[model samples]
Target: MTLETDDRAEAQPTARPSRLARVRAGLPRTGLAALCGALLALSFPSFGIWPLSIVAVTGLALLTYRRTLKQAAWTGIVFGGVFMFWLLIWIDVIGYDAWVLLALAEAAFVMLMAMGQAAVSRLPAWPLWTACLWVTQEWARDRVPLGGLPWGRLAFANTSSPFTPLAALGGAPLVTFAVALSGALLAAAILALRARGRRAGVACAAGAVALGVVGYAVPLPTGGDTAGGPASAEIALIQGNVPHAGMDFLGRPMQVLGNHVAATEALMAKVGEGKLPQPQLVIWPENSSDVDPYVTPEAYQLIDGAAKQAGVPILVGALVDGPDATHVMNEGIVWDPKTGPGAHYTKQHLVPFGEYVPFRSFLSQYISELKRVAVDFSPGDKTGVLQVGPAKIGDVICFEVAYDGIVRDAVTKGGRVIVIQTNNATYEHTDQPDQQFAMSRLRAVEHGRSVVIAATSGISAVIAPNGSVIERTQLATQAELEANVPLRDGLTLADRVGATPEWALALLGLAACGFAVWQRRRQPK
Candidate 1:
């Protein structure tokens, strides 16, 4: 080849644009994205400025509007990173390095969704499409790459907000869509006002108000209402203090088990003395017995003794000798006062890295913490619904409460009361337990079932079907709360249409993107 031709080829290669050049082009938008993320994170538990969720969405929509795909994607990454980092700061309790890795991985999904938002921003009624796009993104993130982490979801933040009633109509996805749509409309109104378009601004403002009306119009069966069906029986929730917080709780397995048994016995003493009313059933926190109660005679005898003394069915959380030798099962076993151990439900949605390391052979080479879970816990196939005394309880263990399907199954499959058995010993004093408690509250409202959360080191609570906490305990304290929790058999609209609303909304967003692409191509150059 001629020297001139070779020179031209080399120059042409540079003209194609280097990766650094492409990335640098989007750099200016990064600050806005990060700011949007910070606002979003602030909307969740602990900070819980509920309106901030809507504001964050508005910021994201405004930042991505009229931006190129590359710029939008960059904005999404920065936004997602900031939000996930803040939301999962509790993960640092495990290992800072692990927390950063997980946060980055989750941020990539948000980045993908942001690109779609940019694609349809030019369309008429773009805000509506963009809002649905947000729902689609959450739907994808919640179930991808080994069961997606549903933490930091917008719906989880709206537990106390006026928009929460939307959850009763169509579950978490609908609540998410409503919040996002309001934000998008508000953003659109602001943009129109900036352009001096009074008519357009007024229309967008009206649209935002309309969302509030619709949310309130939706018949949300909240508060102490008979809409939850009927009162089943009184239940007691025990929060037994652990020996110490963090992973050390596992090291003192006997103490953790002993603590729960002792707490139960103390409550019974109150009942016998007529200081407290008798509970039909008692619930214990997960990992309350790290020692396999079935295999260890000491653990079994201690549990049996507690059940007999309570004179009621006690749902005990225990680590059982697994479905196999290399794996353990985190299970909720029902101990009958007269018959001993009976019906059991093993946790279905095990935490990805915390419970079992994915790609363990490769990941363990770098992450030393992977070895901490020597034997992985296997997931159960069935939903956690069991009959105990006068109530049919739908039990979800630990992080399983964060998953929609896991929580939904219990309600739809004949569970009158929702019981969440969680061991927060590792996350004591961290916002992690508070964030989890928020999820339980939302679940209580979404399914129209009273939720009872029993935790180790602490934050145990009893929530009404309306998502109101009737009783609760403090962290690192041994406490017992007894309440006449109503058992509601009626399912909310969100329950009857399991996952359909999410799927339909997702399809609508995808269609809008397709149409936007077609419209863009047909435009004259």
Candidate 2:
């Protein structure tokens, strides 16, 4: 009887250890997922540890491998929540609640993406499918929940990385795919190494290395005098200081306008002294004139005087009175030295709560913040490829730079150079400006056009066609930057292909998920 009791006690101890071992295994995966998310956030601007993004991706792939769909969903929640909350901490400037809600909303999509990725993990060529899944998530997120928030794409993180030139071939979607595939390949290598399959591990490692270095071979043409070739235009970017940061950035109505006018006048003064070369055109930040230049005579005179002083056209961003009393328009007007305001490009994509609150009556009842945007800003029907003096420039205002279709429309519609007119005052002293600036660099390489950014409260910059920053300004400072930028007319492969690659890759990912479901159902339960 004593011998029997000893056997039973030993069996009980073994059972306890089995449960403990399973719990211990799960704890590491959860912790690793959170760590990976933080690493991915660090890959973005401000920290800019880019290689960490690949490492994070590898960690996620390994953690999710062979996971149950439910388990993968939990992993996604942990990873997405941490990464998005970190990346969008700038939204806390509005409210902590707003920041949390936005991060969670974005994370829900990542959860769905993770479920799809798990489904495909059992399929052959899963690394390719996993890469496609990343594009699929981005494509969907770029268009939903009120025109989507595209702040944390993989392509944005790789703006200056070797993966950037792939953007010239297939736009942002391809760059994202390349980054994801490289990381997934690395994960495959790791799995092979753990299994003692040395040959397989070496092959996977080689593929990842090949993918990382392939962008160096892509030819990015920057047609200019520097290349001893075609057209180039000398342009000036003006960044005017704002009164303060936060929601009340445009203090005292005309104060912001005066700041910009003073900066432009100073720029022309330098030209008069021969200290700076004369520019063919001057670009001003969005909200340079908060008052309607067309309706307000003082605003008109202020802009006209600056253009006259510069002896060139000024792309003036203004808040114009709309057709009705309750609405306004965000427009970029071409104010020529002689012609005055001509050929204006109104902002097409309007910010939901920031520009015009959606479901205003319902949402405003709960959130008092909706009351700030009293007048709804109307959207423009046309693209912003306007003739600004000597150059046919694409005018992408503020957050419009984040949209693929908006920027592509301008490039396809005969824009020789791209000008991003933005106001970073509201998001000053945050990583938001740096993040947006990185997008401009990617856009420059994507469309193969010189990108000129003009920002209020700073980070205004001139980026070359090769994704190089020619000139930039300090945040919240009154500064003027001039760069003789290339004006390229030739269309890049990305421009010509448009959204084809994104669509193809996205569809393929969905198909893989469908196949994975079918495969699972066919299995013996």
Candidate 3:
């Protein structure tokens, strides 16, 4: 058991370790850090998200075995920095300077989380301290400097893991805790392996195995799990490749529509040629139909004809002028083959510099391309569900999949299938799709709902509730994905709690830090 130290004493600087000693204690090996990140990325994309996370976190913890709080922080920071630098390579597609700054901020946030954990090194329960520190940092990063960037989040590790069911309990937070704890136990096992006592090794092995066992016992329930009944509905995702991925192509609405028009015609030809299966509902990605369908009669007629020809419903990612003229909604409109148009869901979350500039009047003048390209499209009410065939679908436009609670609530409102229609054409990120794909997989685990992702320029896919990719198109290409989606009915415990994992960790971490500071303050001079 560890006794809390005085805050004053805790603040005092002690004699620092020599460079070689620090190295031995895992004080940031540039090579190892970079290698760890690459491994993490590699294990993902194909191997699933767990092994990489388990290895990365466990390795970091071992690196800090005999190190001080400061040195431990360095280890975590270096590891996180390298991971984000590669993981977020797509950001470079938009621009260099701004994204680089964003990466720095993101890395700093992760490092701070690590530092917080390091500060609690003397705690009796090191694993618990590590968890608290990590949780604390996650919350801070979510709120700091404007809103927050929740990219490269830890919960993504279990996206393909058997432990994915845990997301239903507390969203990503539960997953993060379990994964970290698994890593912590692994670190303990490593320590036990080197120990002279066989009992210690046995205990560590038992603990690690217990974590895995517990994860397995807590089975996840998919939204489809509680579905009133089971039936398959055919769906289509349209990929309208943009002229180019450059921001310079903005204001060219005609060109944007033209690209989509060409693609839709090709898809129709496939249907006639019997090259593609008949779809019950056709899904177009965000901005795939940015021109208001209500106003663009020809576009509406074109889509209507296709839907009638296919004899199905079509959920189109479109732009809608606000009712009061105060804003224009980045909207998702449901157009039935017979009904023309019915319900709609607007995009609630907006991307900075991409969708619209922050404080367009002030920030707009700073980023020249942003002024020309990024529109002042307002967020839509996501509460509304689009009627598709016999199913009521929720539309998660673009990166909205990144927001956990929002998607959960949609499912709560009886959203049978969550469809994300997005255009990744602007950011020709080679790795961006992989990162985005990873997040979507986790979403499947959390909500237990089938997800249909349609992206312009490639990587359009259909994901099953188990977080497995069913089918996907190649990148930088135009293709049509036609698949049957299962209707989802029930909500998980996590669906109700919404990202509780990071929140719980952040709260406890803060309390621990406060306690540590208090103890140090009370220490004698």
Q: What TM-scores do the predictions have? A: 0.93, 0.94, 0.85
Candidate with the larger TM-score of 1 and 3: 1
At residue 270, what lDDT does model 2 achieve?
A: 94
Residue pairs that clash (backbone atoms under 3 angstroms), model 2: none
What does candidate 2's lDDT look like per residue over 219-268, in tens digits? 99766533323388889999988999998999998999999999998998
What tens-digit string does per-residue lDDT give for candidate 3 at 1-525? 111234466568999889897566442354565566666556555445567787877766666544555655666667777777766766765566556667778888767666555555545667777766666666677666655766766676567675576776777777777777777777767666665566876776677567666756766543343346555677788877776765543237646655665676777789889988777778877777657778878767776775676677777777777654655787777878888888888888777766666777876566555555444667765474667776677778777777765677778887888887777776654666666777887887777778888886767899887677889988777778887777777776677666556676778887776775566457677
Ordered list by TM-score, greatest first: 2, 1, 3
Highest lDDT against the true fold, candidate: 2
State the C-alpha lDDT per candidate: 0.86, 0.89, 0.69
In Å, residue 368's CA in model 3 sits off its true spot by 4.4
Overall local distance difference test of candidate 3? 0.69
* Candidate 1 structure, TM-score to reference: 0.93
Which residue window of length 10 is worst by lDDT in model 2? Answer: 1-10
RMSD of 1: 5.9
The residue-level lDDT of candidate 1 at 42 comes to 90
